[model samples]
Target: MTTAQKRSDVPHAALIQMTSGIDPQRNLATIEEALGEAAAQGAAMAFLPEMSVLLDRDRERSSHHISLESGEAWLRAMQDFARRHGIWLHTGSKPLLASDGRRRLNRSHVIAADGSLRAHYDKIHMFDVDLPTGEKWVESAAFLGGEQICVVDTPLGRLGLSICFDVRFPELYRRLVEEGAELLAVPAAFTVPTGEAHWHILLRARAIETGCHILATAQEGQHEDGRATYGHSIAINPWGSILMEIEGGESDEKDYRLALVPIDPVATKKARTAIPLSRSRAARNITL
Candidate 1:
């Protein structure tokens, strides 16, 4: 008789970058094409950027069209694609209206190779900021905050989920690591100013501190609504090293791109062993 496989044997993963528009169909097609390319490049798992289906800059328009029932189309498409390609897929944040009629949740979904929904994470932190460069975002004004942090077990390893602005909080990553997360996902639609200043440093710090691989998929270039986003989607190792970075240039505008990255739990352990910061922190916290 054949034996059942263990959970720790999954393969390499990929992250997809999307410059989404107000049209859901266009966004779906763009992501589908990117997934096919990533699969061809030997990715066993892939992740999409936040707001992967639509980037409606207008608040009222987003609120008007965002529906949980109607949003099933995107999820169904992702599930079907994962099943057909035999890979795990992570759909980045979507705005789902709550039953209260007062707030919407920014949520993400993970699908297994068999087309099953493995887990879902509602972004706990809302992007409420007024940048020094005269740009402003008040996400809390339109969206409700999530109360729980979500971590999921995958074939590759345990993954802790967070969205754009959540990356700024170190406590969340520490808690996730305490929960035994070996991989972290930070899907974002970061603005050019902040991303240029803090993106790489913050992501690298999270990877180094938590001793986990970080899969960060980001939106690139200016949107149809005249809002600009920083690109350069990246995958980082536990030791704060960059594995693969999807580069964006001044005039380049292709956002439907995919980068295949290999993540090994064994390698992560070795990297952590070299420094042992997480261990040292634990030791220091102990009272004599």
Candidate 2:
């Protein structure tokens, strides 16, 4: 049996929904407060939204804060923080120097309870589009796309990591499921338009498709950089049921919400066994 099938622990995961500003220090403080609260509330793990460290659209101003040196320092600090709390931390995503060191990469880090780096995934799909609201995002112009799929074992079971725009692609989740992901994390900073239009449907579809719990922490409301995000941070079960949801609003420091939801590996097993989509697809030699 796979690791996911053998596990039966249901750990409570804390999802921190924030309206991160341009200040990395301020963002870090917010995360620290939320993590402290989550730990006090008995959460085994905590998740942050994309750009949790810094959310600046202006590359010129953001460049100073997003260096490889600064990113590493932030990771080290967070590692120590997680060690203190004794809770696993999935830092949604942060802006860091790419492998080439010329452009940036949207990277997610998974830190274990013991303060060890377990796995990290760079966002492979870049958001480059023009919407009806006249908002155009050209992520590729500044950030290099990653070329990997990352899944790792944790106390919560096998976790698949993806960021923001990666949710639009179904194949990634399929691959993650095939690799034995019992839970999927899609940390995002989604614009209001797309988040209203597609966020819940897309997440529910992925959960139902993969038979894995979906944990999506998101940036909400208007940011300091002038961009607005749709903030409805949510957790869905393998059966496509909404486990917990925190709605969005005006950016307020006091309004940052932490939602605690139990993640059960048994639910993943039950859903997959009942539907048997994975087995059916494999039996039919499905490929794309």
Candidate 3:
């Protein structure tokens, strides 16, 4: 593990909300610009939205863009970019061909300031759903579900990684908290209906129950692939308070949006000590 350069007792983190398109080059440019800006604002780490590199739903079109993580030039460039900027980066999630050579995976990469991969977590839950708005997503059909949970140390804290659909499963967050995760990352590209109805509620519930800071960088606006996503990327504190948030919706104002939130380890400790949810769980041995 690379030693995290602690800049301050309380570090600030950047949350990037993007309108990523099908072209990987264009998306890379957008993220590069955001990373520079985040570094300029004195952020120690930047968290990007899911599918930061490519967002096309068309299997044939997106298949060509998906490559092995080791051979993916775009990912390497981003790592170099992180090293150059002297900041850590959590690449919300990227689509990559699985090592098995048959299926794809929605994977999140955590790159240290030295450009070394600290950890990578493939999204365990697939967003296979049929929305009320006549939209359907069969993520399991295209991507293989991951089996392991990833929790890693960073400049901010021990981060528990999860993707969009995984947010709905509270058991995952509980297990993450049990593993001593101080922060949880739930990068997503959620549909409008689901986002409006359940996004904030679910995020707050997770934070409150686990007593961990929640950072949900998101993909917003309409994409080149004809899909629209709910925006409003947000950061929630351990007490379920909204620390920072960006606007939601399609706009011609900018290609992306950014916000920096302070991550206070003191708050995490206080919340956990006050509630003691873990102890309560230990007091009971009931299974559902």
Which candidate achieves the best TM-score against the true structure?
Answer: 3
Instruction: Give TM-scores for every candidate, taking all chains together and pairing residue i with residue i.
Output: 0.91, 0.94, 0.95
Clashes of each: 0, 0, 0
TM-score between candidate 2 and the true structure: 0.94
Give a tens-digit lDDT track for model 3, residues 210-230: 899999999998899998899
Error of 2 at 64 (Å): 0.9
Q: Which stretches of candidate 2 lie over 4 Å from their true place?
A: 1-9, 69-71, 250-255
Q: How does residue 240 of candidate 1 score in lDDT? A: 88
- With candidate 2 superimposed using the best TM-score fit, by how many Å does residue 5's alpha carbon deviate from the native? 25
Tens-digit lDDT string for candidate 2 (1-288)? 001111224678889998898888888888888888888877888999999989999989987887774546788888888998889999999999976878998999999989999999999999999999898999999999999999999887899999989999999999998788899999999998999999999999999999999999999888899999888889999999998888654445474788788887689989989999968877999677
Tens-place lDDT per residue, model 1, 1-288, is 111122335477787877888888788888777777767767778899999887887878776667763555778888898888778888988777776876788889999988999989889888888899999899888888888888899877999999989999999998888788899999999999999999999999999988899999998887886788998889898988888888875443544776677777796788778888777877899632
Which residue pairs in candidate 3 collide? none
